[model samples]
Target: MIWQIELIILVLVVLFGFGALATKDLLSAAILFGAYSFLLCLLWAIMGAVDVAFTEASVGAGVSTVLIVSAVLRTTRRTDH
Candidate 1:
């Protein structure tokens, strides 16, 4: 069912968000954030917003993830007190 698919996507997004927050590695966190965005795109598509889903998949998951990963790569991966 559509609702079931939406629920699954929502769960995946939540899990990815938690993973991003809990991850120690910046690159891994960025990847998790990208996964979250991808799940959001799926949710949008299931809701019948194809245009919005396309934009979210491309911009949110693809471009934003690349930018975040590049930024992470430019900085130190570890934090110091």
Candidate 2:
């Protein structure tokens, strides 16, 4: 495993984490979270933890993203005064 690649992925994870927290839109935040999960999966794969990577890819990035996006789409976005 290359340290440079690991460093890059780690940086991206941090950026995505911050982005998800800072985004105002729920959908965008969900997408960022998915990307974050995917990067973590990649890191795990590179580190030789294929099983954990697969689990994260499937459950974290895949199912969770779909569920969050669908939930966001079905809800009404309203600012009540």
Strongest candidate by TM-score: 2
Question: For model 1, how many clashes?
Answer: 0
1-81: candidate 2 lDDT, tens digit per residue? 889989999999999999988887888889999999999999999989999999999999999999989988887532233
| Top lDDT model | 2
* Stretches of candidate 2 exceeding 4 Å from the true structure: 76-81
Q: Look at candidate 2 and give me any clashing residue pairs.
A: none
Residue 66's lDDT within candidate 1 is 98
Check candidate 1 and list the clashing pairs: none
What TM-score fits each model? 0.88, 0.88
Error in Å for residue 40 of model 2: 0.4
> Candidate 1, 40: how far from true, in Å?
0.5
